[model samples]
Target: MKEKNQWSSKFGFIMASAGAAVGLGAIWKFPYITGMSGGGAFFILFIIFTLLIGLPLLISEYIIGRGAGAEAISAYKKLAPKTLWVWIGRFGVLGCFLLLSFYSVVGGWVVIYTGLSVSGNLLHASADYADIFDKVTGSAGITILGLLLFSLINVIVIALGVRNGIEKANKYMMPLLFLFFIILVIRSVTLSGAMEGLKFFLAPDFSKITRESLLYALGQSFFALAVGFSCLVTYSSYLKKDVSLPFSAGWVVSMNIFVSLLSGLAIFPVVFAYGYQPTEGPGLLFMVLPAAFSQIPLGGVFLSLFLLLFLFATLTSSFSLYEIIVAAFTANRFRSRKIVAWITGLIVFAAAIPAALSSSLLRDFKIFRKSVFDATDYLVSNLMLPIGCLLIAVFIIHKMDKALVREEFFLGGTAKASLFSLWRFLMTWIVPLTIVIVFLSMLGILK
Candidate 1:
């Protein structure tokens, strides 16, 4: 049998895991959703869900991965041998495959936009920002090229193996991500009229909470943490036994939430300062951010930096998505990691092409009134993720041996017995029930 690859240090694992968690969801989606869902109230709800649901499930995946000390699918097979539970990991890989297909599409957007910003194409624009965005997304060739490049990047990094490739890249990228966001926040909050946006972002309005918003907050918590789908399971499989799973999970959760807060601080203040509406949905990052940057000094420079940061976040997350698949295929043959990574990257690139062109060539392609891109995203985020979370919660609580669970929790003496009891309760009861309720609400079965 071949030896398994492990992270060189606890820090490397944490950064890589946190890199997976902190992606475009934190930088782009969280702020916009918070704005649309009533700002501080939604933010508070998201944090609650993150703590109660996201954190527990995150630790659950960690336990499964490090406990099994194998790939995502094999983790389940190892834990619940001779059962159908391995399907959970298989579904996770499938979900991740579908996820990265469209995920890379948006990652491609960041890549293309970064190039535009660097080339001065985005500067001195007299046309509407929305029009610029439309032109960019409407160009099939550019979008496809960007998607291919993004996938190639993922392939190259993942091919290098975990400690040397994924971990090394994240160590630099994650810290730089934080630094860049801090700069943007300072610039944004200092802008004239920025206070209104900050107020709108930080002030809670409980009356604005709706069933739909509640569901969104739940989904966003899962999305933001990169929980569910066993992606974390793959990442954690590389962890050393001496490392504390609970501590690692806590940091990943904290870093993700902090980045989300930083993203809101960086974006909303600038949005208000620039007099743009905050409810611009997904376009807030692509459309509104460029316009806001245009008004600031060294706007082009800052825009380029922001795009680079965005690209890093996207690539880091893409690495995990691709890693999950690659890890599965290369489990028994470690030397084949490079070949598997290339093959996986090519497949994901091919799969994502339609989504890349969904705004143009595939514009009319619709499933339930959503374009191919939107439908793919909807299926993954709304349906697949919640279901994955539910299954993981149930499996961890019901299938795993109680002694094993206690051993995992008490391994490093980090978590107390009472805390383990609370975590188990949440995993067994609160987490599964909340996910089911959110899923049913998404299907309109409740209302």
Candidate 2:
């Protein structure tokens, strides 16, 4: 077996894991989905789920990782009772590949937008801003080019290994991401009528809350926390035993929420400022935000910086996703980790092209006749991620030894016996049951 690499420090592990959680899901997906769904009400529900449902699942993933000391797939064989749970672990690893495939494409968009921002292309754009969005998004070439560039960046980072590659990038890029985020929020929220957007985002609308809304809230929490993806498992496998799981979990959630809310403050104001409907779908960031940026003073500078920072967020995330596969292949001795890493990167690039060209190249592959993006997203986010999380919770809470999990996670000694019971109860019942229901609801199996 290839030698396992450990994080040089606790901070490195936390930052890397948090970087995975704080991906396009936070900066891009959260605001658009919140608006599209309803607004503050949906967001508040999302927050509730994050704290209650998301945190416990995260703890479970961490416990499995630290206890088993392996990648996601092999983690099952180490921790669970029956051989069956290993299948869940395998799906989690597969989900990583699927997630990375399209995520690389989106990451490329951020990189391209950053370059465009630096070139002042955004500043002088004409009044028909929506048309500009159409021009960029409708073109297949731009999308493919963006995916290729992002795939290249991920390959380079993963090849560099943890401390030298992941740690070094997070130490600099994550902080800069926050700085640019704050600056953009300040600028976006100050625009005339921006308060209208802020109200839309933060002021709760109770009417919007429903069973479906609750399920969506749960899904958002999972997506935002990156909880169900086994990324935490892969990442914490590198963590030293002395690190506190509860403490690290709290920091990851807190930092992710801070950044996500700040992203809302940044983007919602711009959406309202531009007179765009809050409910515009996936293209909200690329299409709506650019138009909003065009209207700001020094808009090009602000947007250029923001997009670059956004690229950092996505790059760090892509790095983690790639690591899941790299660890699996390398650990299994299929090839040197480095060779597998390169091959994985190339495969991701090739897979992403169809997604990039879904509206163009692979638009008509009829199975229910969905586009490539639709198919890939359904396979990963809606299916594998939730199932993987459910399995991890089951194995940790039921199949594994309780005393060991408690010892590893509640290392600070301040946690009482009752808290362990509560954690176990939540893991056994609340977390898994919720994920199951949400998974069913998402598939239209429940009314």
**Which has the greatest lDDT?**
1
lDDT value, residue 318 of candidate 1: 82
Error of 2 at 243 (Å): 0.8
lDDT of 1 by residue, 1-447 (tens): 233547888889889888898997798779878878898899999999999999999999998887888889999999999999999999999999999989999898888999989998886646477778888889999899889889888899888765777678788878988987887788788889999989988998899998778888988999999988999898877777777888888999999999999988888887887777888766677876786677768989988987887898888888888888988887777558888888898899999998999888989888899988878987887678888999999898889877877777777546787888889899988999888887677668888
Q: For candidate 2, lDDT tens digit of each residue in 73-139?
A: 7887777746797776677777888887777767877777777778877556665555655555557
| lDDT, residue 69, model 1 | 83
**TM-score (all chains, Cα) for each model:** 0.94, 0.93
**Prediction RMSDs, each to the true structure:** 2.0, 2.3
TM-score of decoy 1: 0.94
Stretches of model 2 off by over 4 angstroms after superposition = 1-5, 125-129, 210-212, 295-297, 363-370, 440-447
